[model samples]
Target: MSAVLDIGSHKVVCLIGQQDSNMGVRIIGSGFGVSAGLKGGVVVDMDAAEVGIRTAVEKAERQAGMAIQSVSVNVSTRSLRSQQMEVHTEFASGEVADRDLTRVIESSLSELAQPEDAILHAIPLNFSVDGEDGIRDPRGMFGSKLGVDMHFVLAGIGPLRNLAHCVERCHLRIKSAHVSPYAAGLSVLTDDEKDLGVTVIDLGGGITTSAIFRDNRMVHVDAIPLGGQSITNDVARGLSTPMEAAERIKTIYGSALHGADDDYVNIPCPPMGAQDTLHHHPKSLLTSIVRSRTEEIFELLRDRMTDAGLDVYAGRRIVLTGGGAHLTGVREIAEQVFNKRVRIGRPNGVLGLPETIDGPDFAVATGILKAQFMDIDEAISGPPDLSGRRYRQRRYSGGPVGRSLQWLRDNF
Candidate 1:
């Protein structure tokens, strides 16, 4: 059995799953709770975060009738970003071998200069032989020089350590950490979409993140510390309502696009201090607030892609996921802002998921569970210790090396 924890700004989710004979994950248990002590996907208060994590995990354990010792968690902080690295080496024996592959990747790691940040994922984009590019695997192939293009997802070490410490307080070890956007893409994107190029925008509660996938691998990832929570705050301040009531109103009647009848619809909002007093506001006002904030998010995301020089790579397709994706007219807004085809993406490839939790909001958690069953060859943990002699000796001992090689052959 494997477990995944999706610690978000608005909720904490725990899922326990087991792999079936067909190599698919079946969710046997799942639970979630309102999040506390988190902002923009980073843990701010240890005590409050621990309580939320523990409550979610305990509920899952009760449902699964089993306890867990470790879990793979998702990260979506604003510090999350991606970088590219390339390294090349000559083969002494004129033939590329497993050791040669390892050596090239290790060299790339050594070349990284992010002292304040740690790697969350090291995805091998493609390999090359001699002067030729786009070679997937060079093993057993004759080449005077072998090259590798690597894409690394990185995050601030300080925030990661804080997140890990908060999870540790619940007596659970973090088996691995995955970028929330990448995980969401893994669950929601189709094979053709990935191969043809697509952008996944995770519209989370407190953070909006994007992941660009092409050639069946993530090419870039970025996050901005703004999301659905900002819209809720806008409603609260605009209507003089409490936070709870504002959130309820937003969920029940929020729309990113104005409707012809919105002016006729009236929403009753309880004031902050007195629940007895109600303020009736036209739904048009609420829709205007939501539409303004929603447009800003997509505009910012478009500028981010352009600034990163990845706008061209993003293609004309976009997939929206996470809790904020549930907002009405969000897809249309994204399409208008990005000038791309937009679709609401939901979690797929998992079995036995409850209907209530089987939505785009659960994409990250479901992807985390699916990642354990994937055959891809990439490191999801922190930076590897290539300087260790033990690691060098056992790097290719298990099925991972074979699976990775096969994946490269099949995909690239």
Candidate 2:
């Protein structure tokens, strides 16, 4: 069995499951808790974050009827950045081999020189032999030179260490950590969407993150500091209501688009401090507030994509996930801003999810579970090793070669 924990700005979720004989995941246990001590997906208070993690993990353990000592966690931060580059090497034997593949990947890692940044994922998108490009695997092929296009996701070392310390304080060992948007894409994206090109936006409470996938690999990752929490704050200030009441009202009646009958619908709001006084406002006012903030988010995202030259890679499809995707008319607003086909994506391919939690909000958690069985090139941890033995071992254990060998032994 395997376990994954998704700690977001708004909530913490834990899922325990196992891979079945048919290669599908069957979820056996799940639990969640209200998140605190985290803002913008980074740990702010160690004690508070540890409490939340322990609560969620204990619930999952109770349901699964087993204690877990380690878990795969999700990481999300505004400081996360994406970089794409190409690296090349000449094969010593005039033919591509496993060592050549390892050498090229290591060279890509060496290109990064930021001391404050930590590498989260190093993905080899495609390879080239001599002058020809778009090769998936160059091993055993005759080529004097091997080249690779690599994508990397990086985050601030300070934030990552803080998060890891918090999790450790809860007495849980870290099995692995995955970026938020990357994990969401793994859970919600279709094979065709990934192959053709697609953008996945995870709209969370305190941060909004996105990942671009093409040719069955993630190409870019980016995040903004604003999210659904910002919208709730706007509602609270505009309506003179408490934060809890504003959040409740937003969840119950928020819409990103105005309706003709909105003016006829009235919503009652109690003053921030007064318990008996009530003010009645038209729904149109609420709609206006929500729509403004939601539009700003999409507009910022569009500009970022254009500035990074990633607009072309986004293709014509966009998938929206996370808690913010639940707001009414969010899909329509995304379509308007990006001028692309948009859909609200929910977690798919996993069994035994409760209806109450089976929504786009849970995409990150579900994706973390799915990633456990994927290829090594899909996600790699950093800190270069000179011997290259670690990279070779990991490739053989989790890469295509390992799976093929296992299949052969089982069938033969």
Candidate 3:
């Protein structure tokens, strides 16, 4: 059994499920709550965050008829960066073994041991044997030398510890803190898009993340502390309305691109205060406000990609996921800004999901569940592992927080 908990800036979702006989995840229970105490995906108030988490998980527990002791959560904190590590090593017997691959993978962590950083994921991007390149799995292959490219997802230690503290306060152990954008990519991207090269942009309530996937593995990840909530705020300030009214206006009229009929349409607006009378604005103005903010987001995404030396020059394909992806014209605007093929991505490869909750907004939660099933499949493929404690040591690096993180990983 597995529980996926997604704590975002605007919502907290808990999904409880298990793998069926056919190896597909069956979601038996789900819970959602209005998020509190989070800003830009960072926990700003532990007590408030814990309350929301507890409420969401409790709802899922009631539906599943089971109590969850721990959960796999998504890590969407700001300042999340990726560091690349490439290493070359020669096998003593000229044959690459599982142990040799493990050695090379571990060697890539030397640069990730900074005190202020916590490693969220250490992903092997590519492997090569001898002088040949692009070997997917090199184990059991005879080779004089092996090389590996690894990408490490690292976050500020302060934010991670705060997250851990918030989750702990809920009386639930942390299973694994997965990078939210990576999880979103896993849920929404097709195998072909991954192989041919595609960029996944996750637009959440408080953050927007971009991930580049090539050769079926993630190559880079970047995040901005801006998202759908920013658009809502923009609308509120532009229209001089309350946040609730602004949210309604944005959802009713928001668009990333302006349309021909927008100007002719008129919508009633609430009074700014008791002293002010009601008014009306052209729907075009509302769309324009949304357009400016959303355009800025895509432009920033393009600049970030350019700074990272990544471009759609290769395949020119982009997939948009997360809550903000649902906005009208977002895909079309992204296409114009990046000059690439763009589509909205929703969660797939899972079963028993209700239509109401089955969308890009739930991609991260679904991906967390899929990730757990993948781990189970890997463990079942080989001999049985020893015990949870031993597995933890193999999974997490040894450091001041190693033991604590080992406890966290063991709960998964």
Clashes of 3: 0
Identify the candidate with maximal lDDT.
1
Tell me each candidate's TM-score.
Answer: 0.91, 0.91, 0.88
Model 2 residue 257 CA deviation in Å = 1.0
* Candidate order (TM-score): 1, 2, 3
Model 1 lDDT per residue over 1-412, tens place: 9999999998999999999887588999998877888999888888888988999999999999999999999989999889998898765646788877886787676566355777788888899998788988789998778899999887887888888888888999888888998999999999999999999999999999999999898999999999999999999998889999999999999999999999999999897774357779999999999999999999998998999898888788999999999999999999999999999999999999899888999999999899878886683343222233323333444497785674455334
Alpha carbon lDDT of each predicted model: 0.87, 0.86, 0.82
Candidate 1 vs candidate 3: the TM-score winner is: 1
Q: Tens-digit lDDT track for model 3 on 73-184?
A: 8889777999887788665645677777766675565534565676777778778888787777898888768888778777887777777788888888887777888888
User: How much is the lDDT of residue 191 in candidate 3?
Assistant: 85
lDDT of 3: 0.82
Q: Which residue pairs show backbone clashes in model 3?
A: none
Give each model's clash number: 0, 0, 0
